[model samples]
Target: MTATVLTIAGSDSGGGAGIQADLKTVSALGAYGASVITAITAQNTRAVTAVHPVPPEVIAAQVAAVLDDIEVHAIKIGMLGGPALVDCVAEAIAGFAGAVVLDPVMVAKSGDVLLPDDAVDALARRLVPRATLLTPNLPEAARLLRDEAAGDGAAMQDQGHRLRALGAGAVLMKGGHGGGPTCTDWLVTDQGAQPFTAPRIATANTHGTGCSLSSAIAAGLAQGMALADAVGRAHLWLHGAIRAADGMRIGQGHGPVHHFHELWA
Candidate 1:
């Protein structure tokens, strides 16, 4: 039986990130993809022009419709535009007994704020705790861990602890934005911390990397892979996708990682 994966996220018109990337990643990895769009953005390779949030009722309805019929084995969540949307998603996942991948998408590569200033608190208080796995890049990690004494690995550990306290089973602190010869990501939980590092792949095709990584993890979970193994495979898959994107000329600015790299000639 094919595993079903659901993405509760915003729509990126460019198809580089957000729901589009999540869908592609899930499908490519042999999982069925379903989506509950929380918002829509007029965005492209350049920048986000505008954002239109979907109504809370509609969001709830979408989630209900998908869960009522399909047997979702895993879920990936990204870009819930506001607190209300976050709440809507949390409510949807109330009884879902599966892997939940949360990509805390706030700042875009184009430097646009995908999430509002006020929504951060709500996200931390409500959504973060419910996630099966929370994935946050450096900046978002810092913001989430603002109370810790000076944002560093130590502080990140503190933040990760707090996130796990919030209820997430595990936290993956993605260090892609951290300035280092090697990109280091930490997977932390009440159990322990395991760090994974890889030489940074130099490429501009990282537009949808976060979305892709989370979706890949979800796919692995859907396929009944262990958490550590799922994360490792996702890392390998992303490396290949990035290398594939390095050779393609998709847009004028930052392009998307080649999602079909596994099949590309």
Candidate 2:
């Protein structure tokens, strides 16, 4: 049977991120993709101009529709617009027996605020504990904890542990925002922290990298790979995707990584 992954995220008109990116990543990893849109954004590679949240009732209905019929192996969640929506999504998936990959999309790649200031607490209170793997970049991790972002590897591990205390089965502290010759992502589980590092590629076209990575990890999990193995495969795949990102030239600002880099070559 084909592995199927459900993506619950906002829609990005530009197709570089959100539900678009998640579906693309899932397909590229040889998994089937399903979706439940929580919101819609008037956005491009440059910035998000406007956002229209889907009504909570509609969002709930979509979730029910998907879960009722499909044998979804894993769920990748991103960009719940506000507190009520966060609670809505959390409750909807409470009985799901598969892995849940939650990508706390607090900020867009273009530096736009996707999650509101008030909704942060709601997300933490309701959804954080339900995550099988919590994927948070530096600023996101800081925002979730109401603390400063980590400045170093040790700090990253500390933050990961702190986040795990909130009840995530594993926390992947993404290091893409860090400035350095190498990029490092820490995966913290009950066993301990394992670091995945790659040479940093200098490119402004990193728009949907975080979304892609988390989605790819979800796809891996859907295909029955172990969490660490899933993370490792995604790390390698994203590195290649980023290396090929500059060639796409999709927009005037930050473009998306090539989700189909391997397939195209």
Q: What's the CA error at residue 115 for candidate 2, in Å?
A: 0.5
- Flag clash pairs in model 1: none
| Alpha-carbon deviation at 102 in model 2, angstroms | 0.4
- What digit string (tens of lDDT, one per residue) describes model 2 on residues 111-228? 8999998899988888889999999999999999999999999999999999999989999999998988999999999999999999999999999998999999999999999999
lDDT of model number 2:
0.95
53-167 in candidate 1: lDDT tens per residue? 9999999999999999999999899999888888888887888888899998998878899888677878888888878899988778667666532245665666777778877
Alpha-carbon deviation at 17 in model 1, angstroms: 0.2
Q: How many residue pairs clash (N, CA or C atoms closer than 3 angstroms) in each of the candidate models, in the order given?
A: 0, 0
What are the RMSDs of all candidates, in order?
A: 1.7, 0.6
lDDT of each: 0.86, 0.95
Model 1 stretches astray by more than 4 angstroms: 147-155
Task: Write out the backbone clash pairs for model 2.
Answer: none
